[model samples]
Target: MKGKALFLFWTLLIGFIFSTNGTLVYALESPNTDNYQKDSSYFFIQYNGEEKEVIVNGNITLKLTGWADDSKTTVNGNITSVDSSNSTEDITLKVNEELNELPLNETEIINYRIIVADIFKSEIVTTQELTDSSTIVVQNNNGTSIEEVKTVDEYDTVIENKGLIYYSSGQSGEKLVITKEKYDSLNIVKDTTTIESNAVSEVKATPTTKSIKEVQPLTRFSKSSTPATTTTVANKVPSITYSTHIQKIGWQEAVRDGALSGTEGEAKRLEAIKISLENTPYSGGLTYTTHVQKYGWMSNVPAGSISGTTGEGKRVEAIQIKLTGEMATHYDVYYRVHAQTFGWLGWAKNGESSGTSGLAKRLEAIEIVLVKKGEQAPGSSERRYITPTSVVYTTHVQTYGWLQPVKDGAMSGTSGQAKRLEAIKINLENLPYSGGITYSTHVQSYGWINEVSNGQVSGTSGQAKRLEAIKINLTGDIAKYYDVYYRVHSQTFGWLGWAKNGMKAGTEGLGKRLEAIEIKLVLKGQSVSVSATQAFKEPLKVFLDPGHGGNDPGAVAGGYQEANINLAVANKAKALLVAQGYKVYMSRSDDTYVSLLDRSQKANDLKADLFISIHVNSTGSGTTSANGIESYFYEYNPDYPSKINEDMHNNSDRIKKSVTLTNLIQDNMIQYTGANDRGTDGSAFSVIREAAMPATLIELGFINNTNERQKLVTSSYQQKLAKAISDGVVEYFRIY
Candidate 1:
């Protein structure tokens, strides 16, 4: 017993000496942050091209700054001033500095004038550079590849054919007569306003003012208005009005009410429709066809102005409604006047006719009539409403499925909004109930039910930020979704499948349950069995080492060997709690040469709840017998209070000196084969000392005793030995 105690004492002493080597650093394990916190320093240039800088020293701060020129379009570059004081170092910018804001999404390179002296803990001066000039590239979108001239002088002068003093062939009153071809070519087809397209038309005109009779051939657009002056009047203009129709063809079955659906006119008719997502006359129901067009008055009129007219009674341009579906007998879509920002608008117009324009909203408002397929209808609506973001399907051999919080609004931290499921249509070829349908609901962005284990939940893994611990469960039955769920892939551990209560899904009268979290799937006849009685040192991980290796051939005497002795001791210690229920992750079950670090790493990697490494002492004695037990633990996180370390060290020694553990085993060995009792003592092992959690390494007994060596080799001795180690763990937890 005395000898065994000495071994542990030395082991622990050596462990402490090596801990200050700096290899014991570890991160505090915690769940991910609840929200994103910006924490980076920045610099920027102002509109005047000056530099500034600021640093984010605390939690998070959103640095807000922008180029100063409101009228100039150079608003896209970083706004910072240059620093020239330091000759050997370049100055870095801070986001808080008024003149040092980083351009929005700009890739500003930070150039360091001097090389970093310490990569891990060093700071260097840096300069930031970004794109400039126009800041935002201005493109000519006039369609003709013509040089875009912005200044008034660039494209203003026109060389007369004979220097005839004026360019236009003729002018009527104040009207500039241009070739009819030019008017239609510009395709200036618009309701006006929204795009801010050339409010001031730049057409050439005579420099001097003259009476209508004197200015015979010169022509130009109306000039800036003054209080006393009025816009020139036109003698003749097209007089047009609505034909009392919203749609102009065979496309009426799908039109909705109140939605605008036709083009602008002096009296041109625009089209529209409105529908609800609940009920729909889809394909094979009442399908139809129609022509499509976009009629916009948004620039000139308000989004809320109900009718195709304005407040002052001016007839504003009407928008159009378009379509794409099956050819059918008839179609019915609803329509309602535009929804104004201020409130509601004009009367909702409903149209029912053969000739309809393909541009109408949905058909459910009862505001419009259905147009028969193949019938030509004129005058009304245009626009597509249903928008799509992502699409996914499942395969027979799938990866992931239904997540949790089956109930619609139950989850807390969300990765992102899951794409809403439209319908999973399964068209089977030769299967039971060939026409079955299943509705599926997804709750995670990557389609994964990601679970974060304590050890891995910390920043040790590759997550940009620590990920939360909660999981998202997909609700609803997914089976019978299609002939085959062909594209599903588990975004998490992979192959984690979907659940349907082990039955195919049917959509005869489908509605997802609101109480369900995701369904947990189990293997056929296999289930996850958890015991509440088991103690959980959650967030605490531990790795156990069953010592003595593949061919070490430990202490030998009278047909007895220490290698076998070591394995027996290790096995006994493990069984004790696996029974009491400690989550015990083992390093080696059978004899193996797990490197010291490899064994230590498993424990480290697990950041185990605690660690326990076992082994038996050996000695060369012709007539030998010696036995006892001892334990060890280490503590050293500089940031941690020294008191914590002192407490842990004291606790470890108490266990080593405890008589119950060492005595029970010693008695058994002595009874079986008389041997000397080496008293318990403590010494920290490298594994124990470097461990982030509490740890222990035990030396069971010396194999030098003639009778004891013989007994230690026996299976009976090993089991009794195992019981003692197991008892020790129970005692430790009970007391601690």
Candidate 2:
């Protein structure tokens, strides 16, 4: 039996959906079944199997077998022969009728099996004969009955059932024999457990919880006397938990961390069962389903939820557990079960089953293992939970320095070491977990080298270059589950506060030598007070251009100078922006004229993230009636601009960003000033079109409109405009 080949035959139902005339308008790749060659009309099969289509030949019969010469074949109904050219019924109408009964939005595949006694000239044993030979006994409460059995043989008669049954001690103390007819009709109330027939004996099963063990591989076929074995499963690692429903005993308590959950010595058959995870706060967690004695496998359920029936009294023979979300992204879970006759079944992962389904022998024992799913970058690193602990590190110097031991929150290098450090290493000496760390350093000559992992040397040995700056970050899953804190002692700035993740520990561009460093790892929920860093250390730069100045009055009317109003508003906005942590620049601080090209070029040189051009709109003296706020963003048109350079192309990339900025500024300005909402528009303004980043031009108001001009010149009104624009900039940063 050990060396014998396990030739398993599977019955797969496939339906081909084609358009009219039996021709597929579009083709699709066949399901990874390499044995089949899919085509538009007729598909060739490499293995003998059954397939269904909307219409077959002229007859509405299910296609029984492919051209492949294999023992396994499929048959549907009593059709003895099929001819593709025969007259066929209008299957389109029939298919539509059947579809009408299904929910419009619901999609499902319904399948059932039929056992045939004879094909053309060959006589065969039906599936019921195989089921009868298996001699498995299961109790059913009320009037529910199990479905008919499919093809099965003596060598593979056993199946892992997932449902549970109830039983009492009195029923198990003595062995009784129940005939198939009587057992099927009897209303089992959990009292009866052990029953014997001439062929096999019914045994009760109990589950127990166990602790996680070292990784191992599974042995496919083993005798009952053989000890249980385990090995690696998938690429991602995860924890598993399971609970069992027993006959008469109802549901036992959930057990995890390798502890068994089913009955052990108290001979009682297992019925329904549920499997889940110990912790899944961040992910979709675990999902699993079980194969019942009669019902086969049920629908999938999430962690801690049940799949099989409890009150109906069925034996759980097999099960499959799958991981999802963040948990699945990191690991996979595999499980197997041992039955009374079958000492140990094969291994199953994700959504695969291990035990015999039709065979009624009780599941005696079970094993589950977590395996990693895929390899991540920074190779040897893996994720693990972290607790509060000090990360100790030490650096070896070139000449006279072997520094004192440094722990978490302490600097390791000496700023005065003007001499080069040869090598450095780190360790989580006091932390109680399976994990490591990654660190990188900036050298006098190298300027930032590749990062090293888990107490490894980072700096060069022979080459003498003083370590100027250093950065340390956690490697593996701990990087996301916890925070690593580090600070550096700089040449001039002294000791800086803690920086987490990949934040720089020492100063750059200042030629500051890193004297020492400190490192610590904190659990996610732990509270740790540290220095705060601005979203942008040097606030985001912004360039404000007042549309006109000096000789150019810019749409002056009603004795109000558009240039002065623009300058006043820009100045107020600059003050407010500076106070709000922004580095603001103006094209003109006074009435000195600045060319449009110069304004845009200045903003580009400053590398501003945003630019705003302020101006007053006028429809001339006769059309002074028009007065409203309108914001314009640059629209990139290659033909109209004529000159296209790399910078212009880069500016073109921000067309969408400019639109967003214009809308925000316009909305905020209108809301604040209570001006007419003229809306955001696209324009080809010289200043905005040339400036990089999200630049926009705002026509504040009609200068010729007497009322609007009066309000625009007032200091209070100008401040309102400035504040509104400033708020819009803040909102833009908040979003992007």
Query: Highest lDDT: which candidate?
Result: 2
Report residue 47 deviation for candidate 1 (angstroms): 18
Could you tell me the lDDT of residue 318 within candidate 2? 73
Minimum summed lDDT over a 10-residue window in model 2 is located at 95-104
List the candidates' TM-scores in order.
0.29, 0.34
Candidate 2 residues 301-333, lDDT tens each? Answer: 655455665433345677777777666776766
Reference-based lDDT, each prediction: 0.32, 0.57
Return the lDDT, model 2, position 620. 69
- Lowest lDDT block of 10, candidate 1: 130-139
**Residue 345 accuracy (lDDT) in model 2:** 54
lDDT of 1 at 141: 28
Name the lDDT of candidate 1. Answer: 0.32
